[model samples]
Target: MSQRSFRRSIAIWLAALFAAYLALAYFAAPEFWTFRDRGFRTQHFEMVTHTPQGIPGDPINVGLVGTQKEVVHAFAVAGWDTADAVTLKTAIEIGESVLFDHPYPDAPVSRLLFDGRAQDLAFEKPVGAPAPRRDDGRVWETPCGGGGGRPRWGGSASFDRGVGLSHDTGAVTHHIGPDIDAERDFLMRDLATAGVLISTGDISGVGATSTGRNGGGDPYFTDGEAIVGILKQ
Candidate 1:
């Protein structure tokens, strides 16, 4: 350890691998070429897969793409950005809604929440169960994405179903009914104190999304996100 301190420890490990390749080329997965971009144009799967969103819960079908500001700057540097707090609280709730002890208000059946909604979802049957859920029967709705098919409240939805998530109290309960009521008044309150529920109107079954307008607190709804029903411990 003396040839000029082994070239100063290889120039401090090459300046920490060029500052971790410029912070993963401006935030991880920039097509991964290096030295400030090359041919990095990701965001594909144009006609993605996965299905089912409402009525059975357990969501996973999001494949819109093009919201990458380094994926909201790595969740605002890992402070768990709620999509940047829905651009600062315009509105953005996501998950949780109960009625439980069903009797009949609108009656289709409900209890939902399914927290984190179903992070990185892909399950057709593997969140744990005897497995039998499949609306893969039909309703592959599409068109109006401006590119061709589904986006006017369209295509591939569902990230959690037969729901059963519980980070102890980070809740998740579903079996929905009573029309859904803004996802059942967001499980009986603005997601306990707004962890996230920013739709606008049309909670059809009273939960997932409707957007037909009315009592959605009118703030210009866009896309979706749900879950919380209570239990943060």
Candidate 2:
């Protein structure tokens, strides 16, 4: 074959191969994975939590496949303190801590509801001043069971950026940062680093949202994926 003709044929073959690769990588593979994951998606319970007044709170962005004791131990190993329930004395302590720039490592967090009940467990990791920044996760015992019939704990992980007034009710509250997915990943990373996580996988949540507002009217965004960790047994 002529040199020019041979070169042209080779160029055409390379272009076709690249196009096929793109099709599989961007389209076919995603579709296949989605189909495979549909069964797992249906196992999730409530996608978001609600406030005392029934307003939608934060979206569930993390989960744990374990018993209550295992769940608590995992967070503890990850350097998170189980939050104290909001009460008169604890409330006053958090208020004082915030006002005086003190570190109340296990401060009380406002209650958020899932399945018409207050969170089964809540954990917090204070950052710098407890009032200005903190990592929080509110967990609920989900009806769905994981492998080996272990109870699943669905949770909403969020970062409290600062204390402020609630935009909806004018009540005092903590405003969360918008990128909740970052908080979710951060929590998972902490657990993994602490060797408390056996394995991690993603499930569907409130779907991808760029303009979601929680009960406090604080704006937030997420990739709509919840990471579920199987804690070390």
Candidate 3:
């Protein structure tokens, strides 16, 4: 090759390497510098489980940094009803809701896991919406802790826009709204309104700019900060 061409090639390679380095620096450990000084825990922010067919599930958006009882009490104080366990009877009731145009206040929800196990608690605020329509609910699971101390509950709350087959896995799933932060903020507001939140902070559950798709391929977004709520005893 000519000398000029060789020099130009070298310059292009150097520029590409520098650009790649910058991109890595921007995304790598984003929560570190972004949240280092923040008054919140930064761990436990990752995509843990997939759909029932082994596809990725929803991102963890909110957390309850208290005991199981405190968590349950806070939701109860917020007027959210416990969702019925997914069973034959509950399934039949849901079917009836769809067919008879009824409202099932404590209808069952599709299973989602936290730390490899199904959620320990699930709650929903009845909006008097029809089945397979816009449904709003929250799910919680205590993955660890409880040795004479408060346990942390990892959870996700979202607005279900509709019901359809998974975009990725083809399994039946609820389509979630794009603005998950809205739902997270709604929960925070509900708890604060009910005087259940003693203290609150932030944590890194998912890195910044992660547009996650659940097992059913429903897209969700967040500001990468997990809202940690300490319930009042």
Point to the candidate with the largest lDDT.
2
RMSD of each: 19.4, 20.1, 15.4
Ten-residue stretch with the least lDDT total in model 1: 132-141
What TM-score would every model get versus the actual structure?
A: 0.19, 0.79, 0.73
lDDT of 3 by residue, 115-206 (tens): 54667788887566565654355555565563346777778877777667556434455677888788888988899999998788887866
Ranking by TM-score: 2, 3, 1
Which structure is stronger by TM-score: 2 or 3?
2
Residues 1-233, candidate 2, lDDT per residue (tens digit)?
99999999999999999788667644665455446433432333568877755557899999999999999998899899988878899889888998899899888888887776789999999999755589999999978898789999889999999998777655668999999999999999999999998899999999999999997889999999999999888
Error of 2 at 65 (Å): 0.4
Best by the TM-score measure:
2
Model 3 global lDDT (CA atoms, 0 to 1): 0.69
Clashing pairs in 3: 45-205, 50-55, 51-55
Which is better, 1 or 3, measured by TM-score?
3
lDDT of 1: 0.26
Q: What would the per-residue lDDT of candidate 1 be over residues 121-170, giving only the tens digit for each residue?
A: 11121122222111110012223342222222212222123334221111
State each candidate's clash count. Answer: 55, 0, 3
